[model samples]
Target: MTNKPTILIIYTGGTIGMIKDYSTNALKAFDFSQIVQKIPELQQLNCTIKSISFKEPIDSSNMNTSYYVAIAEMIENNYDTFDGFVVLTGSDTMSYIASALSFMLENLTKPIIFTGSQLPIGDLRTDAKENLITSIEIAAARKNGQPIICEVCLYFEYKLYRGNRTTKISAEHFEAFASMNYPPLAESGVHLNFNEHHLYVPKNYQKKLIVRKKLETNVVILKLFPGITQAVVASILSIKNLKGVVLETYGAGNAPNEQWFLTLLKNAIKKGIKIINVTQCSGGSVILGHYDTSVGLKEIGVIGGLDITTETAIAKLMYLLSENLSDDEFSSYFNKSMRGELTNR
Candidate 1:
């Protein structure tokens, strides 16, 4: 028999980490350090597991870059000591956090899987146990003495997805996330199956992991709709200290060609505000010159987001801005697919 792999679980606060007390009828944090005792089934896996939890869990709504950095630092400090990591976070912000981590960690050669549950672990009908168990198994999976999953990924409802390409589509369902533009990397059933062709094959497995800490959060999304007024556009563009805007344009990245709207966008671009044109449609890509309406956006210096989800666009902008790239460099980098976040047109 092969020696058991060692996996580390980082519990960053979410429904999956809580248990309901029968006496108090209240949900409380379950100590994961006592994991084997809490879930004896884990003993069946051919792996040794360790866990760490935040002192006080922060709600997913309040999650930000600092928390991402903290998680990265944890992995960095224990880089040589652990075989893999499984992160537990709230479903509400899982895509955003997972996407950001995909960009923050460069040259990653180990599996960094994120998973969570819709119901608390203590609930009778909770899906937490399955998600937690499977996530750990995936993290512990290896081939030829190297990890199988070398990129940041999310596992929910039996499917594994590239972190940056996922979006949460439901809050109440067991399957809360969907990669609208990408295919699942792997699927679980009676037998675990991996789509090897779709998985990322890193060029250098020996490259050291580089964690990027600085991230600029001065980005906003402006979803366009029928009868959007100039005043509303002006106000959002005028937000103090705004650095980037993800313009959710109509189908195929079309927008109203009203002179007032174009004028405001031009002014923002001139003021060094980076504008990314993304399609409002759930599945299609943003083609800048697809129609006369969007041609104007292309003319006004708006970079095409090119099939990137809003969550990824926001995180990519934050990572780029943190690097203090010049206006031209920012525009150039946003148009390029750095972490497979967007499709190349």
Candidate 2:
């Protein structure tokens, strides 16, 4: 084997891996076998590169638990062989996919850097080259013969954010992601300046990585809006096989103090449905019992999801639900930052 750090580039399908035919002008997937030739800049990096792709590349809309499990297994299978991994996928559902992987893998000792571009690789002003090259460099970065980033992260634009804490805030710009709750772990500029203070280091790096493949998918996002009727709320809570709900609430997890709303949530919790309160705003934390409106939620056992995006809330719920944790265990774990997803006040 080689002595240089080895980075496995996983192309899971996205605009970043596409090119346009000169004659037909139709965009098509680029053959990653020629990745080195396609992006000659990679040859300059101090790392050995390898690549693998899905048998059938899928768009982000079609991303699901099956693919999440497949990606997790692939990393698990190659955990010992590679020093780091760079995963590329569509930006549309990247937050969800990245958040899911954050919970799926445990005790990570190497970087799992997720990145994608808003434009195709072959476009004149495409952002793909920088994102891809920087991600590889970040993944391969090490200190004292050990990896620097030991958790899942998404590198976009010029910032690197914790995977579970990121959200896609832009649909048309190269800067497509934002992590409101936490500062960026690294920023790319003249030099790759990493905020070493913010990096995640596992409690014990020697612990064998644990793969949590079982994620309960019977979950729904119930966003609250003015004029939302009791009928809509009732219908959702009454969904067959529904086990978890990501309740997107107003500022600070405030909900209408109306009797109908509180009673419905209370009844659902009594029926064993796990409902979590996450703020709808891009930033800030949920402080239950801070306001009169949220007092009922706290008393009714609606778990408070402090500083977690709806994407992370859903993933955390799915992961905890599959653990068969008791009511107390579920609430305890959900409120705390299991993988730097949230902050406890």
Candidate 3:
């Protein structure tokens, strides 16, 4: 008899776990223990399903570093016992959480598929069942006794994207997330078509999974705009304990060429503060030296964020800042792709 793969479902809380009380028209948390009974189709999968939910469900908007650490530790402690993990989180912050986990859980050898739904699971037209069922199946999928997906990924609306690459695109549609900078790792249709070329390959499966809990939250996002003021820029740069900044610049990483603007950034860099220049656009890499406006930014030692989403940028900055890397090392590592969060230029 074949030993069934054990899949662990960690419910961190979200719309997927909600059920509408039709009598009162109120929403309530559904018991995860009754998941198999609620979705009987799960019984058909060739896996032993188990689940654990947060004692107090965390609203998606309340997601923070603590929750990220908790989720990482949960998987780390259960690393040996489970073949795969399925995480349920709110769609609004799924990308951010997923991205953080991708960096936090190092050298993961089994699938960690993060999924959530747009509507309540008990809704007449809810997309929860299919997403939940498919995610578990994907996690349990293996070939030659080896797990197929060995990295963090987001599965939603029939598409499986690299978790760090995902961004929530729509609230009104079932397709809630998009990974514009990268291709889908897999797609759910009549058959689950796995895209072998786009999946992340673990460099060392023999290495034990390391959970990084220390994250530096002294970071901010300075999104550039048409009428951004010098005082505003100065105040942000002057923030006490600010270690890093994700500079969301205009197209192709262009920013104002004003002397004061350049001087502020230069001074910030001199103060041992690291700045990353990522494009505000949903698609395309930050072409730092491609235009004249961005020349000063590049000259001032701002690290170019090539095709990284704002959410991933924030999470990556937090993770990298906690590493205690030298300024030069931080710059070098930030530009390079660590955990597939950004493109390596």
Candidate 4:
């Protein structure tokens, strides 16, 4: 009875916190301070629950770096006071926010789960109640008095997924996200089932949290297509002060073998720009040299993104560039799985 966990819920605005006003027919934010009153299921969990909401909630579309920094700061300031945290954000940009937070917080030893509903909490058919209830349960899950989910994750539609490995794939269905290359960490059925073997186990539990704040935004994504022009390629690669490029190549990292195109990429690398090769397909890895087209990209110094999602690749490049690492160190760290963002070969 002395080991009951304390979980903190941070509401940063989303459909989950809204209720309809009958006369106006408009949605309004609900007070989370009365969360237990609205969702009576929370009282059943064997944990003390507390909540915090943004003073002015913004839509997921408005989420950005500043918001991420603020979330990180809040967790850091209250790290020792709470055993676990659940973040409520809109599904539209949940992957981006969750992935960024996974990278921002290093050596995390407690659960930081993100969840949101597709419908308003007050709607008769809303999915908010279940999502909110289970997200807190997952956050409070522990083993041998230690947090079981000691990493960042997203729970929606009865499935729990690794945060950085996820991407939103639907707008009209309850299953709005999918991890094409990875499996769900946990699933909620008649009984909550966790894939214990797949969980991340940290090596050092006593390490202090390392917060990365200097993320660079001067990166661009160039998706490959048939008949892409050399001039267009050169122009994009030559953006002023460009530090990195996420080249979305064809199957298994294939790209044009044309001299001008290869020359353009080679020139960028020579000028200290870090170019990462990622596959254009939704569910495969970029294996440089697996084909002739991509071989030249590898020869020209492009780093392989290795099955990382485009969203994660972009965020990872920005994070790495912000660290101001040297060209060699940048390439090394970018290819490594710092936040379970990439699959190790």
Candidate 5:
């Protein structure tokens, strides 16, 4: 047995796990049990590495609440056995999956670094090796006998970002993800540089990790466009059993000041639907009531998303809805930061 920290690498499927068969030129999932042999560089970290993969690996596009719950349960069952965890998934929906995990795992006190690559591991110029190796190092990193990072985070193209603060910006570039509203928690280069101040320290290090598995799925995003009409807006509000809507509004949370639009949103709110105003822009905050257009939304009880990514807004809503909080309690919790998903006003 070694004294080095033991890191667990959980593979949920993606390009990073795919290997090419030279003969057929077809891609197939790599055997995670042989990962050490496949990526020999991982041995240099001086840590005990163990890996596990899904029974039947899936693409990131098929990611759903059930898979999110399964991954959380796996971590919950193994929380005490490993010092840290490195999760691998497809980059396409990494932000969404990672953001959901941030909320699902509460009172976290160890590193849970999420990483993926844009290209297959077997490719000649693949980025999979670097992303995988550094993620394990970050997970195993400790300072003064305590985990340096105590929250869920995404590491890609050398930058480590708060998972909930990130968004998928590019499909083809190696730098496929970005945390526009927040700064990097750590960066890998000539030497690993950690932005110490940006790291999240759990309020109660003594508290046990609480895994929240019940995530509501009755939420939808209503992205507003210039030519949108009353019929289109009304139809979405009528989604049966819909409990929440992530309103992708114009800059600074502005929306159409039209009477029909206001009436439809008001009716939805009156019918117990929670509507939150998030900005459509890739970067910036949603400042409700900042202008004439948004004042109407605020008055009608639309919670301001406040610099939160649309991916995170959906995850937080699913999480909060399961707690059975009252309308007032839900609004209060959403308007403020929980799991560092959004900036506080």
Candidate 6:
């Protein structure tokens, strides 16, 4: 006889787990274990679900490295017991959390689907039910008894996206997430249609999952604007113990060509600070040497961020900075895609 696949739901405090009070008209956290009773559609799924939540729910804006480590450890403790995992977090920082998890969990062979809703689960027209139910279905989906999705993913609005590639692009719409650089891994219509070619497959199925706990948070994002003053750049680079900078530049990674601008960045790089050139535009790769304005950046040892999103760039920078690699090694690793976070050149 075939046994049902077991899934673990890790709720890290988000709108999806909230319910309303008719008397006070206030919102409060609800019991996720009673989800099956509230939403009977979950009961129709063929898999068994077990839920665990944080002691005190937090807003996504308050998410930090400590929480990231806790979530990874939770999965590590139950990796062998559960067939898959569905993590629920606030949509505001869902992309950042998802991207961090993608890098933290190496050699992963089972699905880790991150999802959340724009509205409360108890709302009359809430999107939580669809997002939660579909995420579980995708996590439990299998072929020939092997899990079909073997990577970290974000499921929202009937579309499944690679966790590292997704970004929260909307707030008022049901479709709140988008993976502009990559295509949807799967879609929900009359039936679930999966793009198998885009799915990640582990080379060694017998290998165990590796969970990384040490992450450095001494990083800052420097966004360049038309009137970005030299004072602003100097203030950002002068931060104490700053190890990395995600430089959000103009189109195709072009930055100001002024001598002072170039000098500030050049001196920063000389002081062992890693600066990554990522595009400020929502969609496109950073071609450092393709334009006149960007040539100075290429000459100053600024690493091109390629098509990596700012959220993924931040997570990748933090993860790599903890390794304490050499300058050459850091640049080499950053250029290459470590978990499908960016397109390899």
Candidate 6 RMSD to the correct structure: 1.1
Model 3 root-mean-square deviation = 1.2
User: Which pairs clash in model 6?
Assistant: none
Error of 1 at 92 (Å): 0.2
Cα RMSD to the true fold for all candidates: 1.5, 1.0, 1.2, 1.5, 1.1, 1.1
Query: All models: lDDT?
Result: 0.90, 0.93, 0.92, 0.90, 0.93, 0.93
Write model 6 residue lDDT over 1-345, tens digit each, in one string.
Answer: 137989999999988889999799999997987878888999899999899998888889999999999999999999999999999999999999999999999999999999999999999999999999999999999998889999999999999999999889998899999999999999998899999999898888789899988898999999888999999999999999999999999999999899999999999999999999999888989998999999999999999999999999999999999988999999999999889889997
Model 5 TM-score? 0.99
Indicate the residue-level lDDT of 303 in model 2. 93
lDDT of 4 by residue, 109-212 (tens): 99999999999999999888898899999988888878889999999999999999999999979889999888899999999899988788889888998888
Which digits, one per residue and each the tens of the lDDT, describe model 2 over residues 69-116? 988988999899999999999999999999999999988889999999
Show where candidate 1 strays beyond 4 Å. Answer: 1-3
In terms of lDDT, the poorest run of 10 residues in model 6 is 1-10
> For model 5, where is the 10-residue window of minimal lDDT?
1-10
Clashing pairs in 4: none
TM-score each candidate: 0.97, 0.98, 0.98, 0.96, 0.99, 0.98
List candidate 2 stretches off by more than 4 Å: none
How far is 186's C-alpha from truth in model 4 (Å)? Answer: 0.6
For every model shown, the clashing-pair count is: 0, 0, 0, 0, 0, 0
Per-residue lDDT tens digits for candidate 3, residues 299-320, read 9899899899999999999999
- For TM-score, candidate 1 versus 6, the one ahead is 6
